[model samples]
Target chain A: MKREKVVVEKIVETFGLTKRYGRQTVVDRLDLTVSQGEIFGFLGPNGAGKTTTLLMLLGLTEPTSGYAQVLGLDPRRWPLEVKSSVGYLAENMGVYGDLTAYQSLAFIGDLNHINGLSQAIYEALDLVGLSEVAHKKTGQFSRGMRQRLGLAEVLIKNPKLVFLDEPTLGLDPDGIATMLELIERLPAEKGLTVVLSSHLLHLVSRVAHRVAILDRGRLMAVGPLEELAAHAGVSADLEQVYRYFFKNHSQVLSEATR
Target chain B: MKAIIRKELADHFGSTRFMLLMSLVFMISFLGVFLAGQGIREVLAGGGGYLLRDRTFLLLFTAPGAFMPLTAIMALFGPLVGLILGFDAINRERNQGTLSKILAQPVYRDEVILGKYLAGLITIGVLLTALFLILTGLGMTGVGLVPTIGELARLAIFWLMSVVYLGFWLGLAILASIAFRSVATSALAAAVVWILLGFFVPVLGQTAAAALTPLEDPARPRAEELAAYDHVSRLFSLASPPALFGEAAVIMLDPTHRGSEQALRLSTMSRLDRLLLNRFQGVLSVAQSLILAIPDLLVLIAFSLATFLGSYLVFVKQEVRSA
Candidate 1:
């Protein structure tokens, strides 16, 4: 009997990925995969190696062991290729303080080598609801406006994959809502695959189709929200499920110590 | 890469820093022209008798002094501008959380470095050229004198020398910026290095040499003392920028005053003898000057290349993060 070939749909894959700073390991051995056209959220608290993992995926920082591949290209070896297919926005992303919103967008659009750059910039600005402030210097922009501008940069390239490390990090409630809506629409509207890492588990659950929870440089759990909730013996609420995992792990450590 | 370079140039020109530097250059150029005019008038009118006597050495040395303030700015800020261009080249993007965004683009890392470097080089080149034009205009107008073909050649050499000098400082700044993550820290490091190279190194070298070889009293064994003094003087001269620059200026300005005793003695002979001696001295001085310039140019280029390569490697290895 002949066996059928198994096909993998994942656009990003990491195997035993680790990063260390001197004696302390920031991101321990980890395995992860993000399927094509999916919104994958990475959830963790502060100092849980969320940013380090993202950097390694982007090939901005080298991993201590193992490797990551995006679009079937090794991140460390073919970063430019991986990068070209992906758009990314890290926490607290800054724009050139001196440039106006329009100027900054045009400049970034040019760098991305996009066709009809000026039109793309205008469209990005409009998508972010920043058209009114397009002429204002970025230094004068509010935190939400700057975040929107950063999102515009990610959107201008029309990349297949996007890495957003805290897309709404410093935004207000309304700004957060706007950002979440944008994040939710990307996959369906643009055929984009997104990997978003954030400490806000509830926000991640609301916007993402699948979520990976990391704690202390290790993956605590990863799956669809409902699946993780079911496994953790919680109801439909992902927030409660995430809390249960952390509480359960802490209780086990405490019990062992006693 | 061209986009990045264009953006950088736009940012640099839009900055207040460039405006302030331009203002400083203009002020210095005007002052230099005024001084040169006053001196030239005195010499041409022959009103101040014996003013030119024993003053050729002083004149050659003092010409550099007129431009010292401008040269000092080049030595000090060339590195500063380079550091500013590079320090945040990657880190700011990371801090703004845009590094991943940029890296995700099609541009290569080497392209980013090259683009930024080219932007910086262009800015420095434009500034230097503007200053040179200003000086040239003033030299011609204020003194009412056009440089001879030889003088024009010497000025071209001086302009080339300035680029090498500025490159040394700019390269150091780039290295400092790459080595330090914080812009403030990088700027401080570059400033410290500039201080050492510009102000302290020559002074320290001279002090060390003087301490090693002491001068004897003029009263005892004049000839022997002279011999020992000459030997020590050669070593001391090596420590002096004024000495090196003076030798260069003489060959450039006169081209007929090579340091040979026979040539000097011939100048005091008949007019025909003096003319022949001047021609011989010009040829000899040109050769000697070229020999001296080789070491200076080599040191400048070597230091610049070392600094530039060090900065490039450090930047390549740097960890990107949003902080």
Candidate 2:
């Protein structure tokens, strides 16, 4: 079974990746592996180092010690190679308000050094239902519109894998539903692997094929949501299983902070 | 890098702030030319036995009446141009949360800084070149005479020197942006340093000279009695970028300004003696004036390179955390 999985080419793999700032270790010795063409949820609460881990995996930030591979290339050794094929949508990411939506997409195309991308950009914008406002300045965009534009910005390059960090952050109920629908469709429609990081359990439960529960820089559990819930003897839901895993220490930490 | 430069250029050209700055540069240059043209008209109307009445166009650079010359105005405003170009280059992007998004693309992190700095330099070059061309055109129409080859060569050198001088402020502002996370804080910091270098240092240098080397007899101060004051003041003034740029630009654009240091030597020169010196030096080769200004150019280059190096060191080692 392990040999078959190796033959299929795991999209992400890490062996004890760690990051430290001064004396505080944000991401401890973490061993993680994510397979290809599946929506993998990296579930954690605030201050759980999800963003830092994603940054390291994307080669935006260097890890203090450990190994990491994204799409068969070590991100530390081949950052540009990994980044060229990986689309990252950061939490609360901003659009260039000065530019029209079309111009912003064109600018990203230029930055990526892609040639003859007008058709691809238009398709991506239409995919996100932003074609109507393609010529409008992004400064006037609502949060939902901007969020969709950010997704379009990522999708325009036709990345092999897409990492969405808190994709529904600061969105209204309607916007959240739209974003979740888009996230659900990303892997199925685009033949792309996804690493969706979020704090909301029910949202991750809705779309992610597999989930990893992280607390205070340490992995508490990993596997399919049903399997983790069954193993922990809890109801087959993300929130219950997550609570079962972090029940030992999160209470103490929350109380101490309070 | 090309993409970054193109975007930056678009941003600058489209920005109302840049339009206002360009308008200011245009208005000042035209006013300087108009005022200097009136003086040249006076010389033509038998005002005085002025030297180079036929070459009255040179006065537009050397002695614009009741105002600093066009080159001086540029030297004064050049830092503002540079500071505005880069005061928020890094911080604004970081604040907008676009820095990480852009860095996550295929481009290396260094490319962002390199592209932005090059954009500022290119903008400075274009803006100044346009102003210089306009000034040249105005001088031709106002004075009704085209500049000589030597004058054009001098103007070209002055243009290059102004770019280098402004580059110092540009680099410093970018460096400030990199160090500070807030755009407003970075802008205020850049403006503070700009004021210190552009205005305060020169003023402080004169005050220091007056206090340290007070002439015992204010009635008739000897050249030797004031030598200490001149030397001290020049030393302090050279520490400021504008002083270095202004001194070099004046030397190149106005060939008649022998050297600021030659004052002590020429203090004993009578009116006729000065006239004779001007007549002899009016025919001085371009190479001579260029050689005289080389030291100031070197100093300006050094300042620019140092600030660029500082920015590079801070930016390369800086970490992009989860903002």
Candidate 3:
């Protein structure tokens, strides 16, 4: 029964997805699957095509080759439908400074045609611990406060799946902890499936159920920490597991050249 | 789309940038019109033949003020409002990272551009309507004259033309915003275009016309040479949006304005012909003014639609990824 559920609950599936810009390939032949209710981490270095892949999945960008199914719909054919069902928290996403937190959420709600907007705004604000600052203009918000509001924006959409790109990029330690805790609780509390893309492995390790490490537009490894560690013949820690794959890649390159 | 339009309207009306610029335009235009009204009052008191002129009330716009006429002020500065409102419309959203967020919603991509364009048009319409109302009120009280229904109709058409003219500039600004990545670059581009079209074009046209239509006699030029000079200069001036607007507006506001052909004939008239010329060449009907102005009006409309369509095409085809 558990096996059947796992097989039936894939929320994001991409087959050999490839994106190229001019002569440079940004995301290369990536085959990935994200199951429902899981915190799937996309771990990579800068320029590893993590953001490109996310954009392609959201249909904001067209892939050069391959296919992706998001929420049982091909994003290319029905981008509006795919977008409506998904919440995306962009890196460095900004709210209108002139609008209060509640107003910005209301604007988003109206655009998405969401009903009971006030109720949704209040609930989302409370969940993200921004209820007290709901009336405050976003321009005056601290970085941590803004990051929490971004999460609230995602929550207000009430999406089945959410994509968070570098959600804790500029936050302090306290802010990071609060954000991670919020992310960790989302699946259980709201029945959401999250795909988090970030370069900070330690931060992602705390919340991600399974992770895919990518390098130079290629997927290096994908599995739970224990499974990745066993493959690398190292202890089950994300740092060591990550190093094992990248370090092996260099050795393989040297041997082939030799 | 409606939501975007509402948000944009609120942003435009509430922003200090827009308010400051709008108020500056209002104050200057008010000062110009007030000066014009004072002059008109003096003329009214003198009881000159101006009273015999049809649509004499419109002189408040056409009459020379302390410096420039109200029409000249609008011709020079009205484009600034449209340019300022739109120069940073798209790039600012990208820089702030809000564009991607908005696109991620269910909203169609076209809605973003269409909504913004409509919001800008609405704001321009409201502000221009308010300005005309205030100016008309001043004219009625300060000049102690009530406009006839025909004059009001002419004024209404002039107001619509001004909106369309400013909209052309707005569309150009939006095009610049989409073509350039930085807000400063787009702003500079729009300003440069405005300068080229508004200030430099007329001077350039004069120089070009003189070169193209050289006179045989500098002191006592022949009728044909003068006619050719006027034709060539007018042709060159038509290249400018402001010039086009000025031509159409002058005809619309002044009912006595026959087409350019009559103006040319009058300039070439002998002294006896001038004295024998009928004193009662009655003012043109409103229908006559519309017919005379149709060519300029059509070109102005085309200019507006082409520019807006250019921006729409560029915006819809643009990649949403922010650098």
Question: Candidate 1 at B139: error in angstroms?
Answer: 1.9
Model 3 spans with C-alpha error above 4 angstroms: A1-7, A250-258, B265-281
- lDDT (tens digit, per residue) of candidate 1 on B232-316: 5445444433333334444433444443323334534778877775575433343455554656456566766777778778877
TM-score of candidate 2 relative to the true fold: 0.91
For candidate 3, the per-residue lDDT at A222 reads 84
Per model, state how many residue pairs clash.
4, 0, 0
Model 3 chain B is weakest, by summed lDDT over 10 consecutive residues, at B47-56
* Residue-by-residue lDDT tens digits, candidate 3, B1-323: 99999999999999898889879888988888888888878877887664644577898888876767777888889999989999998899998888998999988777887788889988899889999999899888888778889999998988998898888888889889888889999999999999999989888888877898888888988888888887887887777898888888888888888767678888789988866775746688888898888888898889888887888788777778787
Instruction: Please list the C-alpha lDDT of all candidates, in the order they appear.
Output: 0.69, 0.84, 0.87
**TM-score of candidate 3 relative to the true fold:** 0.93
Ranked by DockQ from best down, the candidates are: 3, 2, 1
Question: Which DockQ values do the candidates obtain, in the order shown?
Answer: 0.56, 0.70, 0.74
Specify the highest-lDDT model's number: 3
| Count of clashes in candidate 2 | 0
Model 3 whole-model lDDT (C-alpha atoms) = 0.87
Candidate 1's C-alpha lDDT? Answer: 0.69
Which residue pairs show collisions in model 1? A83-B104, A93-B96, A93-B97, A94-B96
Clash pairs, model 3 backbone: none
